[model samples]
Target: MALFVQPWPIFLSINYLGLQACFLRVFMKIKLNNVCIFPLAQILNCVVYCIFVAMAAGLPFLNPYKSTDDADFRHGVNFAVAGSTALPTEILASENILSPVTNSSLSVQLGWMSTHFNSTCKTRGGWCVNQIKYLSFFLKQSTYCVEKLKNSLFMVGEIGGNDYNYALLPGKSIEEVKKIVPNVVEAIKNAVRRVIHYGAVRVIVPGNFPIGCFPIYLTRFQTNDTAVYDEDQCLKELNDFSKYHNDNLRRAIKDLKNEFPNVVIVLFTIILIFCFVMLYTGFDVMSLQKACCGIGGNYNFSLTRMCGAGLPVCSNPNQHISWDGVHLTQEAYKFMTGWLIRNMLHKLQCSV
Candidate 1:
């Protein structure tokens, strides 16, 4: 039951913190309406989540890779836009951009990388360019170059959650997210298509993680009344909305595959992502509603409390699923990568 992240240690001061109060005031009203019909709404929400997750579960990328090793592991790179959608690269320059890649964005498996690699190390003109950069640098390196290392490359072109967030940006509704999500998914699809245009043989088109489940969203939408649809848990409404997005994305994959049969296209399933998050937040059995890396009390999640110069760290890091309420802890990332290896690696071939 790694679905609940409990004892969400959010700080009380979050209401007064930057952006928190404004988002809460706006989103809470929305949640109040949605949560009022909670049970019925939640059921529908679960159904929608199930549809996409079921589809994702069937993907070849979701297959196991426990037996695979690093030597045969060709090269692996996480070329995701921290909060990107499947769209044009120039969009990053916009003032509205959230998960910016160039001067912003960029993410990591944190402790998973042995070296203290920079987060936005992959200069983001775009996710595709970033991968090509990785492919380029890898080939020019001495100890290990892309040419010598990559017998087969498993490029996880994407897994964008922030677009869904963009859809939720104050001015919009979940339905709006539904409308915009396909565009984002298409942007991702197009990215993969471009990769194939290059020499990448085996490519993985991972859809978004559960946006409904992110701690940040919950913190913003929570209400005193249980009636409204609590988006924090990623109830039926958000999941169903996201499902529609994935459904369209899956069909896009089919369309792309049919168009380019020679190139291998694997879709990363959400089960692994969900399971990974569950394991990280310990939500499978607990609620990581707040962040262990932050300070203060429950507001779901607040940057004021998250890890950095200002926040506090937990004595037992493993027990806390989120190092930052918005991101996963190193232990959580390790568990997720293990899940990925089990669920994706072998199918992409490369042996590991």
Candidate 2:
């Protein structure tokens, strides 16, 4: 899922310096239960960026999980589908919103995971009932599954972003979308619980990004009123909404930690890292609010003329942060993955 951008010689020094600093801080050999479980399963909503995260972690590219895939998950598998939401399609439909890209919501992804587990290993009762058939084989296989799950890291989301995206894109006010925050957070909480139930000892439930800083929202809600925009030139109200979501999500993670004292539940404060990247002096991002691959708007973004729709790409993508208005560029993901590894890798500690 790589986006090809011709390298610019002028920015080479800057990018190299940034990478050097990032590498010095991000030591990628951290282990979880004796396995380097950095090959994350379905992260946030970005399928392409998740690949970058895996790459940053120095793991092999994670193939999207298919129910038909053979029982070889040693390299891990990604169940994330782009544009999928935390809420069900029917639930969004009731709000007069639609998931234009996918019907594979969080629940659907969890179902895939359950199906994968079921196919991979039989229950204790089933093993007992069929002990006479293939006793040694089944016993070894079940033990393998248990150990695999116990060591594996499950990243639930930077999900529920699309729920608001869909609602807000079609003219839902910020207040109207705010009402769905609890439902969205609950859905994320339930996902964390489901993974825990399946033997996941380490889970990363990431909160939403600051939508106001994105080019998509910036373009869509452009205004002449200077008060609406923050010091970062992001929409103030939308960022506030993102904070509201993160605050609620943090409380939910705290509750999960209290409930499952034996499991490690990490709230990846992605928003903080994102803000740091934006505010960092050494990054050399020329336009923090404009899309590198979009056209014809204040933020160089248009709802109709999105990236990869034969739109004009920036000359130096490495110097830009936003990729296609909504998503971040590979450089941005690289920096972010580096920052995440440097900061939160220690926090992914297993419960003793």
Candidate 2 structure quality by residue, lDDT tens digits, 71-181? 334546566666788888999898888889888888887776677668767754465557577677777888876666665556677688999999997899999999889
* Tens digits of per-residue lDDT for model 1, 293-314: 5665453356344455655555
- Best candidate (score: TM-score): 2
Compared with the true structure, the alpha-carbon lDDT of candidate 1 equals 0.41
Worst 10 residues of 2 by lDDT: 8-17
- Model 1, position 9: C-alpha lDDT score: 7
Highest lDDT against the true fold, candidate: 2
